[model samples]
Target chain A: MNSMGLALAILGASISALLAGIGSAKGVGLVGEAAAGVVSVDPDKFSKVLVLQLLPGTQGLYGLLTAILMLSRIGVIGGNAVELSTAQGLMFLGASLPIAIVGLFSGIAQGRSAAAGVGITARKPEHNGKAIIMAAMVETYAILALLVSILLIYNIAI
Target chain B: MGTQYASAVAVVRTMENSLFTQSDLERLINARDRKESETLINSKNAGTLPEVWEMLRTFAPDSKELEIILYRNDFHNLKAVLKAMVSGREPDSYIIQPSNIKNDTLKEAFRTKDMDVLPDYIRETATQAYELITTTLDGQLMDSLIDTACMKAMQESAEKSGNDFMRKYVNLITVCADIKTAYRCSKMNKNRDFLEISICGSPELDKESIIRATLGGTENLLSFLGNTIYAELSGLLKENPAEFEKRCDDMLIELAETSRLQAFGIEPLISYYIAKEAEIKNIRIISVCRECGADKVTITERLRKLYV
Candidate 1:
């Protein structure tokens, strides 16, 4: 029964990570396309746009951290298997949901910002640093959501 | 009075509309022929200068002044400089815009070796700013104080206006001022007066903090974060002033993009103003670069992307 509970919690984390990361992957891919368009115009602007594109990739990192934390809860890291009650399983699901959903939307939003940044860079190359910083601002909330999920998963007990 | 103010806005709107477009800016930046570039600039200047003059007439019909208050401020400083040269005095030009203190009056007073002909108000203002320059132990002290006071005034105005454009412009100006001050302080390696004369509205980032944050440009100093996200964002570029400015330009672009996305009524007007200003500056840059015979690569790097 303990192993079964452990299996469900780990499964929850994996599913959340998959959903969150897919959003991030799509986001970064969109920004990358925008960046490629900008670079085609002026090769020198490559490094600047690259930073803006990298902002969306942070969501993936957050999701991966959530997965790792969830696995640790199941004692996949340092201890024997710990089983979570059904309540704990629901808690894990609730906590991860915010990150997954917010991460998806924010990631897409970041891509839009990156596209704008790319447009600016095509004209004002120096503005790249500022562009990346602005996109990063939107990403902050998503990261905060990721942190919430990690803390929630950590507090859960079998 | 309401009609007058409305007309002023209308004139400004019309002038804003007539400003050089993005395509004009690109043409200016890319122009290889000197005569052609000058023709473009002169024609643009000719077209806008009259509109601006007309607007000023509409604003203060009787006065009909040709002066740009800000640009004249630069002229006022230049007058201070010329007077100082004639009188064997070192005066601070930063506190008062050069054109404000009556250029002809200052020159006349200086020419006669008498400061009395200058208006009492102008003389008093110049004297206070001058004292800061003359009494200070060195050039460094004077520069910091004047820069601080200007930055402080700008910050206060920005805070007071609270309108999005005014606030953002003020913040942008303050951040740039911070970068300039920090750059000066780090290079001179001055320690005692850094905080004393630093701009009040900045987020405090110390010398080690700035060096760590910017990675290369400045050394020991403090940075004060203002009441905006741009303030903290500025810290990341505290090390490289130029890079920080570029970042600011990008932030403006982001703001413009967001405004476009939201389809806010006022946003387009503001964005067009910014973009047009960038266009004008880019043309000016091209003119200077061409005159100075700077290479294409160098000129391109310095050109604001929006304009060129």
Candidate 2:
């Protein structure tokens, strides 16, 4: 039972990182393709397109932060070892779910928007700032999810 | 869906800067001599007609894209060869040499008397057109045969593309050409026999109604068009046929440019190509008008709207 409790807690940390990381990877790949397309024509605009390409990558970092925070909160890192019951482990998993589910979907959606921003930059570099803002708007949901997961994990009894 | 043309679209975005503006076209129209026109074109790093055409050929994304845009030339060359061959003239100067159908291959097909060398879309008409003039010596009959074949090929290709814009373009061109054909046949007093072979069929326009209207006369034709999407065309046809053509061409440009705002798609790439083609066509028109020493007013009236 103790082993199962530890396993579920580890699974929760993994989900937060893995799902969000996968989403960000998918998003960043899509944006990179768009950036490559723009750079193929105008090599000078690489710097501009690079920013758009990196925008969708934020969700991955957010997910990683949530995973790290949750890992540390449950004394699974360089802290005093604690034998968590199955219900407590399940609670930890539930808390991580906010970031895990949201980050995954939000990352891919943000990447698509960022790719569109790259197109705008390719055509009219002057509007790149506005394009960036538009793409950044999609990251709001991911940020909200991160905040909720952090609050829940922090309040969960050790 | 649009990713296939990402690189090409990117390239097309850069190419937009090269399209001639209104003032540039006005200068070309007002140029005094061929040397002056050549100077203006060279200033922009685009030489004369053939040079600009070569640039487009070099930049086209794929052979299918090339085929769609240049098939008219291919059909024109085949028609020219059919006409020239019967008259004992060399067909070299008449051929446009499409990427898909090589001019040399066509020349060889003629020399060897084997039309199989030609693409399927053209082989039937090329053979029929050649035999058409050879047997009857009727130039009009040969002309209609090739014209019908060209329209059919365009229709089939547009249908195959499954693109809405392409289908609309096909509809506009066939309908416009049919209107012109109907007008010409009216004066010639030709009956429905010529109409049956001449008019290109489109799902957008009822061929039977148009044929009936054409047989009835201009009033009947105008009445029929009034009820269709081309309602405004009836008035334009009565007032000025040239303006009517310009309006239809403008509609096509608008349809193409609508895709320009799209972030991802082959639509923008294809639209840019169409716009460039229209620009080149206008240049050719103005260049020819200047060479012919046409009056500025007449030349201005004939010039189609520049596609920017």
Top of the candidates by lDDT: 2
- Model 1: CA > 4 A from native: A1-158, B1-4, B45-57, B60-79, B82-101, B105-125, B157-164, B198-241, B249-277, B291-298, B305-308
Model 1, residue B200: what's the lDDT? Answer: 37
DockQ of every predicted complex: 0.01, 0.37
TM-score of each: 0.46, 0.85
Question: Model 2 TM-score?
Answer: 0.85
Q: After aligning candidate 2 to the native by TM-score, how far in Å is the CA of B206 from where it should be?
A: 1.2
What would the per-residue lDDT of candidate 1 be over residues B1-308, giving only the tens digit for each residue? 01122223222333343456666756776777877787777776534433433334444543211122233253346345654654577665433622334445555554575667754324433445456555653555544555555555544544554445545655555565556555565566546446456543444333344433333334223343333344645465555565666566656655554444321123333454455546555677778887898877777777665521
Lowest lDDT block of 10, candidate 2 chain A: A1-10
Instruction: Name the candidate that leads on DockQ.
Output: 2
| Candidate 1 residue-wise lDDT, A49-144, digit = tens | 788778888777787788877777777778776667777767776767767787777877776676566555555566667877777788888878
Candidate 2 residues B1-308, lDDT tens each? 34344445555665565678788888988887889998988776643434444544554535354456566788888877777777889878777744357777777788799999998888888888878788999999778878877888888887787777677777777877777777676657678988888877678677787788888887778788888887887778878988888777777787787887766565676677667667777888788877788888887777666556
